[model samples]
Target: MIRMFIRDEAGFVVSAELVLIATILILGLIVGLSSIQHAIVSELNDIGVATGNSNQSYWYTGFSSEKDFANGGFSAYTRGSAGNDTQDDCDNDQCDISCDVPVNEGPKSL
Candidate 1:
């Protein structure tokens, strides 16, 4: 006579610890990249400000004559003057020795 034996099969196991570790690593990488992007943007903003001042200074020095001032830099520093004329076709609004132009089209010439 022969006896039959039954065997139990083992199922696959999923480790929660490994999943948590992977998630933390991904979050850290995302945070690091975000910080890097923020720093780059900040530096670019600073650069833009510096270059803007330099351009404005050039306009002031080169086009500060009475005639150019009357015609608003003769189309050179047209938008970099102390007035509020929107026909100058310039990017930077009118600026003077005291304050900058308001975003809402107000004048504060110094």
Candidate 2:
């Protein structure tokens, strides 16, 4: 029976065809997946570059700061504040500094 089956050769042809088809399919899938991944990475990189190069700075409009409020709790050093401003000092960044600069004392929340 084994010798007869081996002599047939039809099954071998079918198996070879299946192997070829499977290889083609796998190769196609790999190429497609690679392309998709590359495209996504490129898009993400573009987004990152755009985000990084974006101008997230706020224009210097003006500010409303009281030199004295809540006792004399002020120092001569404060980030994004007057040289003599305390942590409690008024700053446009009461919310977020990204959309805040120069201090627009009008509307607080945007």
Candidate 3:
């Protein structure tokens, strides 16, 4: 019985198959998660752009009214200034260093 148990190969193939399936699953999960990360970043950047493009300027005119023999009421005008959105200097497309040299190039006389 001991020898037969030791020689049994029936479960060996199942174990190998399980390992292969798990490896494949893990690899696919990694790829899927990377894609999700990229999509989320893209969406967030779009939201930032949309927010930057929104206009908040507004204005309202004054009003006044008079009665038979008296001054009734009056309101002053109001306005808000608006400005164009400037390009971000540190945006993703321009944030990377253009040169191959390291930022902290060790002392020249090292």
Candidate 4:
């Protein structure tokens, strides 16, 4: 019986068909999974590229705008007085009387 079973070629075609079907399924699965992975990687790369582009294109000259608050000759300016008065009393007498008097000093140093 064992020898007859070993020598039988009845299920040879069925085994070949099963192997062919499994190989085709495995190849299809590998191709489909690789395509999905490629697509995901491409999308992530695009997102990264977009981020980099936006960052690079961003321009900020300064935090605030340049404003000139200069007063172009129209500011609140007032003219000074005329001059000086040459007729003033100095101490208890006239300004030119004892104006050149020197103070009392100690001994002079060598």
**Number of clashes in every candidate structure?**
0, 0, 0, 0
The lDDT ranking, best first, is 3, 2, 4, 1
What is the per-residue lDDT of model 3 for residues 5-99, given as tens digits with 9 covering 90 to 100? 98887754557889999999999999999999999988977776666556545554544443433554434434445555555665434444456
lDDT tens digits, residue span 57-108, model 1: 2223233234465555443333343422233332333333356667786788
Q: In model 4, which regions exceed 4 Å deviation?
A: 1-14, 56-110
For residues 46-104, could you state the per-residue lDDT of candidate 4 as single tens digits? 67555544422232232333344563343344444344323223322322323566889
Q: Per-residue CA lDDT of candidate 2, range 1-110, in tens?
A: 99997678564355788999999999999999999999997796667555555445443334344556877544443334223322332233232224535855686695
Rank the models by TM-score, top first. 3, 2, 1, 4
lDDT over C-alpha atoms for residue 103 of model 4: 81
> What are the models' TM-scores?
0.39, 0.42, 0.49, 0.38
Candidate 3 deviant stretches above 4 angstroms: 1-14, 68-110
| lDDT per model vs. reference | 0.58, 0.61, 0.67, 0.60
User: Which of candidates 2 and 3 reaches a greater lDDT?
Assistant: 3
**Per-residue lDDT of 83 in model 2:** 35
Off by over 4 Å in 2: 1-14, 58-110
lDDT of 3: 0.67
Q: Quote the lDDT for 100 in model 2.
A: 38
Q: Evaluate model 2: give its lDDT.
A: 0.61
